[model samples]
Target chain A: MAATRALGPAPSKTPDKPTDAAGQAPRRRPRAWRWADIAEFAGSAASALLLTWLIFDRFLPFRIQGVAFFVAWYALTLPIYWLVVRDGHGPVAARDRLASVLVTTGAAVALSPIFLVVGYVTYRGWSVIDFGFLAETMELTGPLSGADDGGLLHSLIGTLEQLGIATLIAVPLGVLTAVYLSEISGPLARPTRLVADAMTALPSIVAGLFVYSIVVIRTGWGFSGFAGSLALTILMLPTVTIAAEQVLRVVPGSLREAALALGSPYWRSVLLVVLPTARAGLATAVILGMARVVGETAPVLLTVGGTNILNVNPFSDYQDNIPLFVFNQIRSSKESFVDRAWGGALLLLALVLVLFVLARLAGGAGPGRRSRRKKGAAK
Target chain B: MTTQESEAPVTGQPVGGTLRGVGVSAWFGARKVLEGVDIDMRAGVVTALIGPSGCGKSTFLRILNRMHELVPIATLGGSVLLDGDDIYGTALPITEVRRRIGMVFQKPNPFPAMTIGDNVMAGLRLTGRKTANREQLIEESLRRAGLWNEVRNRLGAPAGGLSGGQQQRLCIARSLAVRPDVLLMDEPCSALDPTSTRRIEETILELKDQLTIVIVTHNMQQAQRVSEHCAFFLAAEDEPGRVVEQGETEHIFGSPEDPRTADYVNGRFG
Candidate 1:
């Protein structure tokens, strides 16, 4: 009763101060793009560029240009922009705007390399790339042959075969290890997790050397695509395991308790309820693992003996993949060889993109998302 | 005991099973929470365990269905009996005991990945129980939980899309689909609004004849409204929780044997 007495009545919808006859306060309209903001930005940027040009051409003894000029202009733009914003929106808003500008600049700087690499690869390789180039192989083409004479078909096949084998070997083992760590958590969990974490930092070249020494030399497997896949699997496992463990750990404990309360055994609860709920995240983990090993050139170079001729069978003779192809061809003095290497690099980028899209499509809708397939209906 | 006092039979199916917690005590690691709590939750009736926060009410509720042992350090010191059989004994497997005695938690936890119909039938698949008529069982369970009409059209929709109250009811339906003889609800309606709470109360009243229910609640009015037998739990400073009083709801509320019970029921002190 004392608690209820201290509470008091609910507040009125409108404030007690001034209001219109309808008991409504004045509305503050939301504007996504204000003309004043745009003007201030344009004015500050133009003045900064002008100041940078004057400093380089007239004020300074040296005429530094190119990237340095733009860098200087960017350096000057911040303070100018801050001052202009301050004139319009006061100091506090100007500070907030400056912080957002810095964040955007940081993001742009971080993203520049991806854009530059993809753009340069496309520009250099687009001339030699066509359906014929994709369909044909380097088996018939000589060192003096033109860029159009050979294609990446052999290397493409080798890369796909090796990646598929590696994924098949690694994903199950990694996911199971993750499940054991998160759900079962026995005495070995600590040591297992420690080993997995340590292996994540293991150099790709070391993985290649280990697999080469064991499979290629010890077992006399030679340098086959299978040897290359074994190397890739060693690199891929820890990545998948660590990422998958993190994902599985975040699944709400309530779901586990709910499953247990329903008379579901421990293993059944993990298999049916926990794993299915974390499906999307596990797919992402697998993709991250694949991405880490796909462009690994040193490992494939050491494990997979580079071959010009197409070799579809991974367990037999030497095979060629995209990274190895790019590495070998780029070293040649011929313009055609260099062009083909760029084309291979571009194709590799496109392949990774395609794999991401395919994995996303196959992983299906995440938990709580509308699947629209009607396949989840009860029996 | 309340179990012997209520022996009237008015149902078609094999109705509520008597659940008794005999001298139940619980500990998390070394710290004891509940000590020697014995209560007779009579068949075909709802027994409400009311107590202040941190009084081990929820722990006792979890103990009934063996969910208390899920915690790594949680330890139990007594036996829970369902239908005259010791649930803690070697006679029945842990999974079988849980299947016969189901539970609903305070927060609604419908599987987000599952559809409404699938969530209801999840228990059967989880426990590996095969039913000949799955659709009929789902419908019957939903009807019993009073959530059939609201979700019948969207059975294929994700269970997570439902409102909080509806999700709680769906959890209830999921628990009911296994056809458990006893249902333990741990403050099932504490997170819901007044109307949803009232609807769940009505569902509880309707379900009393089919299976035994033991609910732990903090609200005295809810305890009085939903349960026939009431047990008040209390824990003094530096002591483990124990039952202060246990009797019919009317007698416990109107004329209790303990002054603490009266003070608690009257909102004077907890």
Candidate 2:
């Protein structure tokens, strides 16, 4: 810590990352025109695609040819494009273009599924998601009910209440664990951190099974919303602790030192300085942990025992939740049930987005926030 | 200065204390930084510790207020007396020791989240010494730090709104609000511009009348200008840092007793 601090505040100017140390005075490379670069890339892609289609589709004996065609096209285009760029520009430009290509392809591959799911779900469900479908309950409806039959209000309420209980139990425990890991140091810190990391990788269904054994089997209790919350808390704790610890770790040692030097005790300094400074990050951690567990179905399936009707009392009886509701709908053979599953999935996505926006707004400003006060005006 | 006849400056009484260290040695894990360093800081005088980088002048400054022990690997040996009582002794709580001896860091670290007024009163509040006259206290501390005229209208604003110079002055005001007996500054102007540096130098000169001050500075000229007494630290090849010479500022600058001190004062070698 001292060695790094000794280096002083991050340098304002990095000298634009000093260019290669070649002794020769390098000539200024002209920037290729934007349209020319685009034209070059498009031409390369088209030629590669045409060649692949002609050679692979026509000449190959295999009936399954889409994957082979894609592979052949990519393999042929990369080297050919590299040579063309190398001729017009330098080796550095060629390398830069190749890296850009790889990154663009990687991003497209990553984003494809998200777009696919959103579009597919909306296409199947948008017509079914009317005011009545969202506001009423599914208690009277059968598995084969038509489009005008059921709603998700009961499930939505159950989800919100179960999450509330889980948050109440897990957030405090996770925050304390994170504080212990990041601030207080002792012999147990290493082992405690290792256990937390191990727990984070523990299967979500195992959390459900563990809670089922304790709350349902051992205590001789029926399936209830509280059981689901307990399982969710177990799943959420490790994630919240890990993320919160990372946030606390970067709260600048100087702030703590400043408060301690003013005669505040260690805990007091942490409360008045460290925690406040990391508030935004802690909010982010809580959001991430909540998001992870909110979409889980296996835990609720084992513990809560899904119901169709609204039950506001989480402790006394079984209750419906969004993921469990969607899971049950999708498993049915009826087309109406599948459309309901899609509607529930879309609603769940919107809920997460809304929750994130609300959390950010509630966080206000972190302790690291600099002065936002405008220049003093004449009175 | 405001001609308001307000009872503000009394909160920052400018009370001074006599500080003496005898054979102080410090270590971070196995690497010793200060080796048996001895110095005296008398009431209402400026004692400067000047050395090149890695010479442990900053380490010694943190030692005075027991801030050095906050680092887990750091260990200290020998006694530092404040008004004839050992600050490192178990008789007094470490918090009280820190309360009596305040520090201004190399960087102006006014808490970015706190308002200007809150930043000023932060030290007093931390020590649980915040009195009923907090409004007056903030005004006086800022005045003592030579920042009143610039920030008096915007006391409720965030401390970070100030320029680099004003922020350092605000930090000084924060330390002064606790009414400490001694003030320790570690290169307070190193991060500031020339104009801000000159203002801080002026604050040091004026503050010398009421506060016993120990400052660690890398700029030899700064040490000569602000400190009445000067201590030179040098780390010989493969040796921990130790004081080479100590005397009045003029004596150290004009005619240093040791050849090494003379060479350093003349800018021959750090």
Candidate 3:
């Protein structure tokens, strides 16, 4: 059987290959378009639209329009499209086109909510945000005051300081814990990993309560930015640790082995070679951790008693952040307060967006991203 | 190719150290990979270990530099000696053992994040050893690895930008910068094109005078072309790898004591 198989015609010699139909040269590129495809799409869309309109307006007893009309049209479009494409092309092409459409639709559906939230916030808050709004504070403003009278300057400062303190405390500890988990396989690694995994799932409110009990109630530190920072730290630690560990784990074992073979002690290899190799990934991890805790309202609300005045000292005094400001202002039954709350929400969204952009920039062309050298054909 | 025009002789004195393995056995967890292997790799000559896949050639090469121990469950028996001192003994630190006996893997592995110059100088920085002139040392190492002129102007370029062959040579220069007494290569040319493989073979020949070179290769012609001495390793089905024969390259290829060695050299069953 082996000899017969080996003696038989080679696979390349076979004449029935789809790519070489009628002995013609194979077309390397996939034909993405045809005149019939456009016709099929147009026909499917028009027929679906007409059918939905007739069903809503004429065929059905009740009249439906607006979003429901479009939703009905969309629902009817898929099968119509499949039928049209199947007739025009084949079952394979029809299936491929349907899959592409479904995937694209799913992506659009997933992204729509984010767009709606951002658009709504921008529309409501665009008129309120200005140079003065950013520069001024709400120290003198009251619930009766106009929306234009007070700004989120105090809240912004509190957010920045609290995040700053939280980052300082959490990032180092988290990164060190990550190093222990990923690089060193000591006895505590399993238990430490378990704790960090559990902490990642810990509710934001629980983190706030833990800090509230330990730092605010027990230590009598009172409701301050420091306490808020501690709560944020508790929330941010597991995030940074897990992410940093993931980043560290990807620093190729070959690189570490190369370092060791070069006579580097293990710690030195990890410190100089392994850490530097994973710098961009580590930065991204930190940014992810920051994003995780940036919009946390419960922790800020529970630890830092909301205040109106701009307080830069995170160590003392009640301070308010953007989320807390939004939470408190939105609950009030005042138009101006609601507008201010929308403005705060917009600011928080903008901050998170900025952080994501920064993460992209930091992670994009990391230290030896492909050759940037324009000259010399060494190859 | 352009770099070879300026045939600047490598500056460093030949400091090759004789290496000897006595009854070296290895196990990965409970599975025995190699058993009672003995070989002598003389200084200032290229010694090639030719074997089939899974015959423990690479494993033995890694054992020379103490890289074998990096695997968590890997265990070793017997001793490897460099210049008549037990490398596995506590007399020398593990880092020191690795430094003296360098390694080049099958695939080129320069630190992707580092610049070309930095990659060459990585050994110095990693080992925390200082030099009088950093620029001079970098140039010297690159020159010895036969990669100087091609990369001379772009020393600051990221190492990741280099071609596969250039990267391999850069790894060689990185290893050479540490000035190791013995260099162990585990099929260093297997990942390269024919031109790159030839270039690496030429490099191995050139570097032979400056360091004791021990290479593991499945390619018989490569072993014949580069090595002065050769050891043929073999393993039967479900058996641990062991040295079948050892002699000069000429004798091994011409008239081997073991028929298996003859078969392997003549392109029979690996």
Candidate 4:
């Protein structure tokens, strides 16, 4: 046909594309750090030192002489890229290369602190952590001793129970409130949104004080795990509500319209269609909210009043969480206590990493549509 | 190889219905879209609603089935009758009105998470018609929409994995699953390739014996090809839209009564 004639044969992309596909090209060499990379990095670093020398001697009073140089190096990259890359790759490619470099540098600078903290703690904490540190209680040993003296087992149980109660309280309330805000149209939507936004910024200490006054003083229960969990619930509700609301809002309008056209009532459509579509996002919200509050020492210290002995009854007695355990260990003036504090920090890091991995798995499969590979993995 | 002509035996008898709108006008918030529009879509015939862009042909189609009212700011000043009974009568539920009158959108919108077979069964399940055999219903609906042969082997695959044309046909199959009396389509083939468009057109012509259909389209030649009855809508310079002419498709295209209709059909102006 005329249309087929108009299409004709396609133009080749790269000269060797077809040959490469046919296995005509030679095998590739193993990659290595090459000579060109040295010029790029050396140029970037020298620019930083030169800018620091230019600025610190003349500009201002403050002695930001050390940090200013390292940061100034990033800004000096534009001129270097424009000078070194423009003639070879033209203006557009040169600009793209410069932008990529700037973004990569920014990412490296931002991530350095996280790596530094994990590295430092891992180095110090390895000595204290062992089979004994994981399974025993601090009740048996003195402040000055080896890994045989104490353990995080007691703290682990307290953290789990408190967080369980907190999850039990916050998840339903947050999901329901999000549904009301996103699905139902009513007079109370705006005011409820305002209140949730306000609560997200509520200081952890204030939540602890509020729970202390309302539950601790009224019931005369001094410091129980229940009170600590109540404070955690207060801190967690806003995060879950706001995130779940955002997820629910972006579920495409076409989907609801499709369900409605099938003669579904509003509530049934939301339950069957809208909620299922947002299932993964809702799981992410719960995990993130849990992570946000799990490291709180201020609220737990204020309410749960740290215990050294093993306790299981959250309803009746004081308990210890890892943050409170680490705080107490550091407060003691023994070298052994500092090592134990680092060991507790390492455990907390592992727990957080586990939560992130769980979140990634849950977030992998699309709410309604899963990749065949993901489905195979699930099976 | 076409899903048509095979005629799976889900329906005990063929079905269709009539729709009539009287003095219907619509508004979105403060802006009036349609003014004093009247139309009758009869059973067992294809009625094409045609106009230039923004002439309210699509709005009129949505209004016939009460979908316009779902918009938060939209208000309708009209009465629509389904087989002589007012759809707005307080005794009839909105759910019943919608179930009896089904629709296909401008774009293919199969539920992405659902399989092809499940997409066919969605309307039946949602509308509480569980007495029908689920397997027969899916097969008959896909056959009616002319998609059964291409997809018979992969019915359990996600509907989203199908190509655009197949997805559109799957949507048609989905709408047909409920066995509605009337089916409304909004520019069903505008987003498809020419081959898919021809296939959907053939399906439309074949489906005329079973359901009343009102299709909104901007393609004039397509209107001439698939429809029997044609209604032309037009609006001038910020004015509300209204029908200019209506009659048999052959007559409308050959010798229009109105100057505007003739100009539009002849491609002189929109």
Candidate 5:
């Protein structure tokens, strides 16, 4: 036994004694109850029940009752963090963890009203999303004209065309201006940055007015998709440029020096290295610019005079866009037209969501390729 | 072999002539950084510039390739003759000069988004050397830098994934892929570990047979170990940076002609 102890046990054998100061078996930690987590769970359940009751119960208007429920739910959950978790009366591990949960739950409850509004719109708008509603133009004179009369196909096509033209004009100009202001050091960059900052705060209506003064009143060109696209471009250029510039500025200086030191021309370096490094952020900026311009009713009203039929040519005649169609229908006193307006709003929201999803997918794909390459390299 | 004997063949060789700077001075908007500096770099050899921080060793290296002109306010007086032609002549394009003389920064700055292969080929592509087989060149360059086996399978991976030592070797590979006649490295091994430093020192020894290399370093032992010739830069009484002495590395370390060089090499004062 002494020889065995001196040599230690065989490698495959397990130790028989406990390895602790007390020389007894190790004690398992007791799981503690986190009150703040339980409170958040209870609060979410209460909010869901109240929302369900408000929507299904015949005694209350969903709009008013739903909003009130969310308000109360948020108010109740907001203080749980301060009262229970922040006071640290609970177990140490539970305190910090539950505090985060309560705070997040409070924020979610506060934003619940916006979710309710979107749900209501989507629910009411689903009925008009069939093939007939999508394939026909709104040139008919009557309500619920099934398959042969009215559809949003024309407006959809026109909206895409107008936005495309607007992006074509805006993206290049915006990116170049941003690059100049941020990268090139000169006496003019300061003043140009100031102008860009000022332009960021310019009102959308003011942009429309500026475009109207230049392309409409001065040039004697009547309202058309081309003019509207020009107006939207004016509104969106500053936004995209500012966002792109900020993203580009955040790219580490080492990357730039690496490319330049490799004998790459400055412009080539910007094109191949700098641009691809910030491609995700740039894509997000472009999508944001698209979202800003796609729903501008004021500019479309002032520039692209609403037409009942689709006009494929953006430069020549008035064109129909979803937002303009919705605005025109909403102003009419017909209930059927109002329903169409709601449906159009839903479609526009869906379009923006799709763009957002595309931006996210593209961003996801770039980094995925990088990580996959890393894994392959590791092996 | 003696220090003078080892340097004799390099100084006298006529294949690719030596680079010589005479009465060289650099100024940045009326601030003088280097004053009346004169040095000669023997062809196809490693010349180490050893100095304290802010002694303008890096600035002097940049001047060799006309890289200082990248700064809009930077101006230089005097001539840098490369293979008998004046590099500062108005007729020579700055881009062409940089292509023939590549530089690596103090920090290893491989393009973060680019693949290792792409980073190595960056210089060749920029100079429009399209006929060069990219894969072969990449493998050759990485092998020369002693990084081939480590990164061979992951040629498509981002260069930023490498550790600091690997990144520095990648930077050296990038400079080598351009096939420049001269390579300027600014404190290449300062940010690396001992093993990495030893590997780089080996790579430098292997490279000096083919291309002339000028390196700036703060470590005196590294300078003594790797360089065939060494230049000592120090701050003057009133001026900031001037070359005190430059000769064979062994002579400069063993028995220097100047007192300042002896003091610095002996660790008396910087």
Candidate 6:
């Protein structure tokens, strides 16, 4: 066996091992520091410092002024850090957050101009918003000597009358047309929908011209509140129809099935279930339609000629709306007339605000009553 | 079975109110959905209709109550009889037929805007039943549906606020409030979880005493569990659906005469 031993035979003795590693763990290389993180921190700190300096101190002469400016500036900066810097650490970097913040802040700043304009209006208009200013009519046409001689009671009444008639004409017709479009299915429905879409884009001035041509030029009728209402109806119909249709379509199909399964007729289902479900949205639609045509000056100017005195009758003769009254006041050479115009503008704004509040209250009351009734029945 | 037979004669008329179909076919414009089908529904028992999707099980269910009449293009052949009376006869009113035969859909479709109590009272009010005892009827209906205790204090709250099971129970309560002779349920438990499905099955078993029930379901176990009579509808080669076999639930599940029925019941195929 000794003579026949192989050249590469295995060693019988155990190999020597290192003696320095008695129950100790191996060492690891230190991790490389991330420069990007440090760069981001420095960048944020620098931006914050710059914003603080620009806002707190007068570092830039053209910088925004006062607490309003500081509030707005901080409001703009907080979102930038929250949205942009926090998400900017990924592998594929993008400026989406930054762009969003910039767009939103830019829009806020752009719309801020309206606040100043309204502030100026309120400051000037408050002096003329007294009870006497609302109680009397703006029939007087004298110079700037009489301070308590004029008010906008008549013009306010005329505006209400015209808008009310317009709503009466437009809302039912508009809502019915929308219902027909949504529920009735046939070849005729397509053309009807197309006509509604086309009508939606019809210009307010064109609507005025349409009414003027038909009622005034062709029928030999004089400019009156009725004609003005017809013109306003033309402006309001498409708005109501489109909005009501959208609200009606949003009503769940399940509600319809629930009604139909009860063996109720189609009209009964629509009247009871469908209408009640969409009542809140329908009210909103009506308010929006009223708001749209309430401020029309061209139609009123073309159809209902402006008057110095108020005319309550909508049929016989010309009547003055708030817009027409304001136009007449502004065109007059007298300073009192100009002051009355400002007052009338303020009054119109107040009327619209009141209408919006009432609409909101009406909408809120329905759901409240419904929930209360449900609770009563539950018990 | 003896109790059902005895009770059927005491409720207004005798002979256990029968609904029969004879060589009935239906078409949706050019498409032939159901072809030459015949079935008989007996009062006071649960009849299960099992089929795959688009096999016209729902169409057959709808035909019983004349719900298909609402569709402009849907056409029908032959006749459906209720108590040996032709339902499609010119003398009978569709509204009256629907009022007598109430339907519950697959989804738990309680009117979201209405309160639980109002939903239960909907069908009653629609039929001009404005009696002074409406409150009692509403309470009784909800209690019978096993939903009164949970929704007793919130009758005025919107039905939509209830959980899925509660809403399904509420829908059942609504159906029962009308006192219909027959209840047509189209996959009522298909949208429900197992626990909800169990509760609805218990409700169905309880309701079988007062009304005839026809249920359309895809779950074989559910059909076996809840139904007394079972009808298996299978898709044909050229046509869509026809009844393959029907009998007592025990025979259908345990020892069906037809090989196809055995295969389906044993889970070899649907």
Error of model 4, residue B228, in angstroms: 1.5
- DockQ of each model vs. true complex: 0.57, 0.38, 0.52, 0.36, 0.43, 0.38
* Candidate number with the higher DockQ (2 or 5): 5
Name the 10 consecutive residues with the lowest summed lDDT in model 6 chain A. A1-10
- Across A274-373, the per-residue lDDT of candidate 1 in tens digits comes to 9888888898889988988888998888889999999999998899999999998999999999999999989988888876886687467754454455
Judge the docking of candidate 1 as incorrect, acceptable, medium or high.
Answer: medium
Calculate candidate 2's fnat: 0.47
Q: After superposition, how far is residue B171 of candidate 3 from its true place, in Å?
A: 0.8
Model 4 score (lDDT): 0.83
Cα displacement (angstroms), candidate 5, residue A368, comes to 8.6
lDDT of each: 0.88, 0.84, 0.88, 0.83, 0.78, 0.77
Clashing pairs in 6: A374-B156, A374-B157, A375-B156, A378-B155, A378-B156
Clashing pairs in 1: none
Query: Candidate 2 chain A: minimum summed lDDT over ten consecutive residues — where?
Result: A1-10
Q: Candidate 4 residues B178-212, lDDT tens each?
A: 87888899999999999999989988987888889
Cα displacement (Å) at residue B74, model 2: 2.0
TM-score of model number 2? 0.88
Interface RMSD of 3: 2.4
Model 3 DockQ vs. reference: 0.52
Candidate 5 docking category? Answer: acceptable
- The worst-scoring run of ten residues by lDDT in candidate 5 chain A lies at A1-10
DockQ ranking, best first: 1, 3, 5, 6, 2, 4
- Name model 6 segments beyond 4 Å from true: A1-98, A109-126, A145-149, A213-221, A354-368, A371-379, B1-16, B69-73, B236-239
